[model samples]
Each structure stands twice: as C-alpha cells, then as structure tokens.
Target: MSSVGGGEECTVTEQQLLPPPPVPRTKMGCSWLFSLRTLAAGFSLILAVLFFHPSLHSFLVGSTDPNNPFLYVRNFHVWTRRHPQKAQDLSMGSRSALAATHFQSKQTYIIIHGFLGSSTDGWILSLKDALLNREDCNVISVNWSAGSTTAEYFLIQPRVRTVGAEVGQFLSFLEDTAGLYTYQVHVIGHSLGAHAAGFVGKTLNGTLPRITGLDPAGLSFHQADSADRLHHSDAVFVDVIHTHGCYTFLKMWEDCFGIDENLGDADFWPNGGERQPACEDGGDGATSVKDGSSCDHGMAYVLYIESIKYMPSSTHFLARQCPSWKHYNNRSCPCGHPVQYMGFNADPRAHGVFYLNTSRTAPYGLLDSDCSAGAFSLVQIIGLMMLSILLVLLLLLVGLVLIQQYFGLPILARVRARLYMEDLVWHGLGKSPSTHILNSDKAVDT
Candidate 1:
C-alpha cells in the first residue's frame, strides 16, 4: 500500500512539472492590428499638433517678458497726415523728440486697430486721409503689431492692457510736453482696440473727452465686468456702434466677434446689429477670421469714416431713438421727435439706443426730407378703415351662417317670418289678398 501511494504522488508531480504544448502563432493578424494602431496614433498626433500650433508658437515666440517695453508697449507707431508716408515711434523714454514734434494743442485723433492689424492698413490710411481732409486735427494711428499680430488671440489679449497703459502715459506725455489736452484727444478704436481705448480712458481716470468703440470685441470680454471692459464711465462720452453683434445659441467662429451690450452713452445698431448690407456671409466666424470676411465687423469704422468725411451735416445718416428694431421696421415711432446722426456726427448728449436704415452700397445714409411726416398717409388710413369694416361685416355674416347651420334652417325661416310680420305691423299695413283668400277658404271649410 505504501509503494502504491508513493507511485501516485510521483505521477502527479511529473504531470504538473511537464511543459504545455506550443500554441499556434498568428503573426499576420497580430501585425495587422499593430499597424492599424500605429496609423491611428500617428493621425491623432498630427491633428493635435495642427490644433495646438498657434498656442505653441505664441508661447515660444510671443513677448512674455514684462521688462521689455519695446516689444509690448513702445511699438506704437504714430502716423499723421503730415507724415502719412512715415510713422513716428513713440515711447515713454523719448520725451525730447515728442516735445519738439508736430503734435499741437488741436484735437488729436488717435486711431487704434483691432487684432492682427497694422498702422499701414488701407482702412487706417483711408481714415487718416478722411479725417485730415475734413479737419486740421492730428491723426495718430496706434500700431502695436508686435503684440497684436500674433496668431493666438489669447496671447495678445493680455498685452492690450499694457498697450493701453503705455498709450495713456503717452497721452500724458503729450499733455506735459506736446501741448495736447485730454479733452482734445478722441480715441477711436475698432474691435479689440476699442477695449484697449477703454483701458486708456480708465488709466487716465476718465478725463478723456470721448472714446468711440467701433464694435468692441465680444470674445473674452463680452460678459466681463465693467472694470474689465469698455464702460460708459471710462470716458466723458462713450459711443458704441454694434455692427457685428451676433446673439445665438450656437456661436460660430465669425459670429462671436462683437459685443451686443450697450457700453456707451449712445449705442447705434445699424441694420439690426448682425447682418449688414453689401456684406456677403463669410461662411462662419473661423472662416471670416482667416479670410478677412469681417465686413459687418469692419462696417462700424467704415460708417465712421464716412461720417468724418461729411461732418456737421445733419441731413445724412439721421438716426432716431427707438425701443427696438421691430419698432423701427414698423415705422410706429413718431418721426417728430428730435433726430440724432450716427457715426462722427453723433451727438455727445444723445443718450439711448438709436435705429436707422442704410443702403447696401456706399453712401449708406437714408435721406429724410421731412421729419414731421407720419409713416401712414390719409389714403392709407381710409383704405385700412374700409378693409376693417369689410372684415367685421364678413365675420358677422360667417357667425350668422354658423348659427343657422347649428340651430337648423327651420328656426331661421320662422325668425324671418316673424320679422316680416313685425315690419308689416309697424308699417300699419293690413293682411295681403292671398292671406284674405286663405282665411275665407278656412271659414268655408269650417
């Protein structure tokens, strides 16, 4: 019995120690799966690189050094009609040159461009020409392309506050050394630059005369507090033009460019504030940002340029205060109220939302010959009254037909007979000959 037990244990140990048979290897299937995974990983990496290129490049090459004012703040290239061909580099350190320069005590117009813009842009030059043509004011085109031209909008946003401080300091230097006053300074900014101008005004403690925000930027600042954005208190008078303010649930790339809030004393919403005439839709916000299809966003400055070109003329581009675009379209608001002109001629005292219609092409102003003329004419009123009366009579006839249908035609017949008898009695007419014959026949039958 001891020998048998030992033999069984030895057999079990041998079976446990024996090696298993080799499994079949599917090299082709394994290689195919591995190749597919490698290809998918490579594609995903490429997409990630493409998507993060802008931010990465901004981080690498963007001016993050706070001490280097030249890269961030001193890049402002000042341009005037006197030197339209050249630009003057103004910085905090260079006080002697600015003091001896062509800046006078006259109204100084500072034009600041939005994201990815330059001082030599065609619109800037055009605006400079228009302003110089109209008045003898000093036009300074604030060019901070060093900070503004970055592909990453987020990277450039922080630099705007610094640029504004630099600009405010520069304005102060002008007051101290160049004989320019804050009241004489009018800063006109488009898009992101508009908020930068607000920063400048805030830095100056709201002493600046006026700040014209041409569609102040909506992204990163739309829902920001008043301290962070362009508020009416930023300057003595603030006027805003909402040309590309898009309010929708799904904000496309191009749609989120301009703020819809009224950040100024007077807010002008031209053509309902989103779609402007003559501006073909540029697909979406991303496409517009890439292809420069920001016609609506740029229209604010265009309208402003036109206004400057034709100043002090109350006839062109007349705008009236309205509760909404609906009221403007319906022409329900009485025209007898005092009118305010949009753009450069906008009254500083004008306080509220103003509405106006513009043409699809250039010279966009709608001419108003008479301010007191009512929207509806006498003939229109009479026609409307007649149509209303006809509608009421038709409704009454329909009601009567419905009643007769529901209550039976016999009831209607009886009502008509009773009405006829009443009319005869009221007229004092005796019974007809037919009735008398019928009565005699009845008496003979009886």
Candidate 2:
C-alpha cells in the first residue's frame, strides 16, 4: 500500500490520532461580571447597614430551614416595631435640625462623635452640660446621614462657611446688644470632635475660630506632623489634654498632641488629670481621680479648674489665639494657670506659671470635670513615653525580621541549594549513566 506522503493529507488513523480542537471559548459578556460587582457592592452595603443597626445582625442572616424564611419575615416586622428609630423616625432629622436654632447667631459646636459614636451617644449630655453652663458658648450638635463624625466629614468648606456665618451672626448679636457679653466663637471637641475642631479652624482661617481638642482623635495617623495635620491657627489655643485611651497608647500623646511642647515643665503627662489605675472606683461615679486627677479628654474646663499649666503662647496653644492677644496687647489670661478666656479680651498665657512647677492652684476649673491635682504624673508620663518609643522600635525590628525570614531567607536557601546541587551534578558527571545515554542518543541522531 502506498504510504501517506510527507506533506500530503493524513491517513484515516492519523486524522483520528489528532486531538479535536478545544470548544470555542464562549464570547464573554459583561452581564455576569457586572452582576458580580453589583453583588459585592450590595454585600458591602448590607455590612454597613448591619453595623449601623447591630441589634438586627442575627435576624438578617438567612437560615436553611423552610420555616426560617417565614420566621425571618415575622422577625423583620418585630424588629421594625422594637427599634422605632430604625423603621420609624428614619429620616426625620435629616433637615429637621438644619434650622432648629431660633437665630443664626447661635454658634454651632457641631460635636463630631468618635469612632462608633453618635450625637446621642458618647459624652453628649456631659459635653452639653459643660458648654451650656457657660452661657457664653452657644452650641449645636451636628449629626450626619453617614455615621463618621470626623473632621473630614464635618469641616468641609460649605459646613465651615455655614458655621462661620452662624458665628458671625452670633458675634454681631454680641456686639449689637448692650448687655450681651462678647463671644469669640469657640469649640470644645473630644476625640473625633478634636479633628472636627481642627478642620473648622482651618476652614474659618480668620472668623470662625477657637477650638479645644480634648485629647484629639486620629493621633496615630498624624503623630509625625500633628500640628500640620491639625492646622488650627484660627483658635487661640487648641488647649489639648491627654487622658483618653488613645493618648496613653504607645506614647501617642507625646508623639501626636505635642504634650512635649505644651506640657510646660510637666515632664510627665495628664498634668493635674486623673490617673487610670488609681481611679479604682473606675470611671463609673469617679468623675475625677482621688489624688485629684482628670481622666479622659479634659482640656479646657478640667485643666483650667485644677490650675494646670496655661499654654505659653500662640506657638503651641491652638485654642487660645495669641496673635489677637499680642496685637490687641491684651493679657487675657496672663497669670492664671490653664488661663480662662472670659470673653474676647483674655490672656492667661503670660499670667500663669506651670502648676507642676508653680505653687498656685485653685479649687474649681473651667468645665464640670474635677481638677484637684492638675499636675502631670511623673511616673506615668515617663513610663508611657519610654513604653511607646520601645513599642514602635520593637515593631520596626519585628517587621525587619519578618522580611528577612519570609522574603530574604527563602531566596538565599533556594540559591544555596541550587549551587550545592549544581556542584554535585558537575562532580558526578563521569559517574552518571544518564549523561552517557544522552550522549549516545545525540551521536545516533547526528
């Protein structure tokens, strides 16, 4: 039989030996991809919704049983009934508080709550009580559709202008009225509120001014250039007090809050503030520490009352605007520790000496929180600083070690093994039958 020619058509068996072509790749469509992305986004939304309403977390997850669907339907109704705000009163306050104030002059505090915080939650009543007691300070609590109460959210140009306008009106009111005291426009925010204060201070630049960042939030994010991150020159002194959990964490207070600059002879921190472990009765009713310390974010009111150190000048104290003090040649709080800015004309900066280094201390403070022993604790302060530095260093070393082990060591080991195996192969070349067999095969092919 004639064999198949070299370049000619294959025999019947040859055609059968060849594999069939792969099925044509389905021409892809955007529908499934689009649907997948949509599903992912929807899932993210669900997570957000669940976080917003933690109470409904368990009920929302579907169960396998047939009756579970009906059960969930019934439970959904029950959930709506139980938590009125979730179902009822949902968007009631969107624009409701927008114009709630009687006049535009009422300065808005816009207390931005911290992480996992709401206006109603986290020192709302206490903060309100403190500000309200001061009749001089007009307040408005800002609540947003999104829960993030950071300065990034609340201190936008629009909000800044709105707040500035309100403060301007209030300033006008103070000026127009005969008996009304002069209002310099201020804000006292805790944690995230501190960031909001910084944002507003930056936004206002000149008019809407004065912010007291009580322990200031986002310390870690802005530790290197805390002042730059919180550019609040508008306010007199961003009177900062480090007493919260974040402050003491890894010396964040010293690193971020400029406690070093403002501590003013207080080598230690929480000068005149409460000590945590010492506050055995705990934060419950123990508003202030026994040795008479201030805990949590107690800057303006708490520090001033206990006769803590007043900021040296505008260089450091953001809440207390010093240029105004210098330009006006007004010693608003010249001699008073934790100087109190009664109205516009106040200067306790030059007025007071560092309480830790000074003998002068008063019985009461600017705000409601106690200020008995408003001196920085040397032991606690020193320990925190050292601890924070050590922790940061330790973390850096650990990262380096991990890099060496996970990335460097494996590559080095592989290279060493390769070199060793190569040397062995080269040395054993004469003894290898496979190499000989390969040489013979090559000779035959040639």
> What is the Cα-based lDDT of residue 177 in candidate 2?
43
Q: The CA-based lDDT of model 1 is what?
A: 0.74
Please state the error at residue 173 of candidate 2 in Å.
Answer: 15
The candidate maximizing TM-score is 1
> Compared to the true structure, candidate 1 yields what TM-score?
0.66
**Candidate 1 lDDT score at position 439:** 52
Q: Which sections of candidate 1 miss by over 4 Å?
A: 1-71, 280-293, 334-338, 372-446
412 in model 2: Cα distance from truth in Å?
A: 99
Highest lDDT: which candidate?
Answer: 1
Per-residue alpha-carbon lDDT of candidate 1 for residues 1-446, written as tens digits (9 for 90 to 100): 12574565323566677798788869998999999999999999987775567644433454443533544443455656676667676655566556545666888888888887776677777788887787777888786754344568886776678667778877887888877888899998888889989999999999998999998888878678888888999899999998888755567444658887788998989887777774754323222222252878887777778777654444567776889999988887554233577888877866888877777777776676655323445767788999999999999878777888987655555556567666766776538774466557547745
TM-scores of all predicted structures = 0.66, 0.38
Whole-model lDDT values for every prediction: 0.74, 0.39
Residue 24 lDDT, candidate 2, scale 0-100 = 64
